[model samples]
Target: MSEVPTTRPARGRPRDPGIDARVLPAAVAELAEKGVSGFSTRAVAARAGVDRRGVHARWATSEDLVVDALATLTANLRPPLTGTLRGDLDDLVPDVARALSGQRRRVLQRCLDEVGDAPAITERFRRDHVDRCTAVLEDAFHRAAGRGELVAATTPARATEVLMGSLLLRALTVGDDAVRGDALDGVVDHVVALVSTSAPGARS
Candidate 1:
C-alpha cells in the first residue's frame, strides 16, 4: 500500500495587512526626503520599522514602490464638483498649484528622471495620474453638458491635456513662484474660458 503524503503547515507567518499601511507611507517619506536615489527596499523597510523582506513582499522593485507611493500622494488631487465645470476647475487650481510646487515638485522631478530607466513605472505613473485626471475632467464635462453649461463638441481628453500640460509647463519653467498669487488664478481663468468657448454655440 502506498503511504499517504503528510501535509505540512505553510512556511512563513501570514502577511500583515498593516504592513502596507506602514510600508507605503514610509516609501513616500523616503521618496520625499531622498528622492529616487535613496528609494530602496532596505531604506523603506527601515523607515517603516519592518524587515526588507516586508517591502519586497509587497513590491518587486524600487520602481514599483515609487509608483505606488506617488499614486498615494496624488490620490486625493481630483477636482471637486461644484455644479459647474468652471467652479469645479477653479476650486482645484490651488491644490494643483500646491502639488506642482514644494516637496511634491522634487518628488515629481525624481520620478521623471527615473522614467527613462523604468518604462513600466512611467506607464503606471501616467495611468495613475494622467488617466485619472482625464477621467475627472470627463465627468466634469458630462455634468456641465447635462446642465447646458458646455457644448456637446467638448472633449475631455483634449481639455485635460491642455490643463495638465499648462500646469506642468509652468511648474517646470517658472517654478512654484509663478503658480502663486494672481498667476494661479490667471491660469485657472484662462483654462475655464478656453473650455467654455470650446462648447457648442459659444464664441471662439
Candidate 2:
C-alpha cells in the first residue's frame, strides 16, 4: 500500500468577506422601513434569506451591525466630483437633501425624536454616520483644494460641517415636506460662492 500524503485542514471556517456586503443592503432596506427603534435582526435575516446566526456571526452587537449597514449604504452612494467646486457641490447637495426627505431620513428622524436618551444608538449614529461622512466630505474638499478650486485658507473639516449643516437645518426647517432641488442647489451655490470668493484673484 502506498503511503498517503495528508494535508492539515485549515483552522476554523474561512472568513466570508462577502457576508457583510451581502447582509448590509438588506439591513439598510429594513432600516429604511423601520426606524432604529423598530429595527430587527430577525427581519433583516429574513430579508437576506439568511439565519440570525449569520448576522450574529458577523457582528458582535446590533449597534455594530446597524452601523456597518449604514456605512455600507453610504459607501455605495457615489458623491460627484465636478471640475469646479460649485459644480461638484451642486451635484452632491441634491443627494443630501433627498436623504433628508426619503424613508431613511424619516427612520432616522423617528429615532432621534424618540431616542435622545438612548446612548448606544445615538453614539453609534454620531460615530458611524456623522463622523464618517464628515471625513469623506473633508477629503472631497481637500481634493477640490488640490485642483485649486478652493481657497488656500479653507479648512476642510469646517467646510464639510457647514455644507452638511445647511442641508440638515433646511430639512429640519421644512419638517416632512420634500426639499426642492432648487433649495439644495441654492445651498451648494452659496457655500461654493463663499469659498471661491475668498480665494486670491478670484473673478467677481
Q: Give the whole-model CA lDDT for all candidates, comma-separated.
A: 0.75, 0.69
What CA RMSD would you report for each candidate? 4.6, 4.7
TM-score, prediction 2: 0.66
Summarize candidate 2's per-residue lDDT along 78-173 as a digit string, tens digits: 556666666666666666666676655655666667465467867876776767666656777877777776765566776787888877777766
In model 2, the worst 10-residue window by lDDT is 70-79
Model 1 agreement with the true structure over 1-204: per-residue lDDT tens digits: 998869877789767789889998888888877767666778889889998886787788888888888877563556587987888877766776777887777788777777776678779888877577557766776676677665445566666677778888898788898788888888877776776755445653
lDDT of 2: 0.69
Instruction: Give the local distance difference test score of model 1.
Output: 0.75
TM-score of model 1 relative to the true fold?
0.75
Q: What stretches of model 2 exceed 4 Å from their correct place?
A: 1-22, 29-34, 75-83, 140-155, 175-180, 198-204
Question: In candidate 1, which residue ranges exceed 4 Å CA deviation?
Answer: 1-18, 32-38, 75-79, 145-154, 197-204
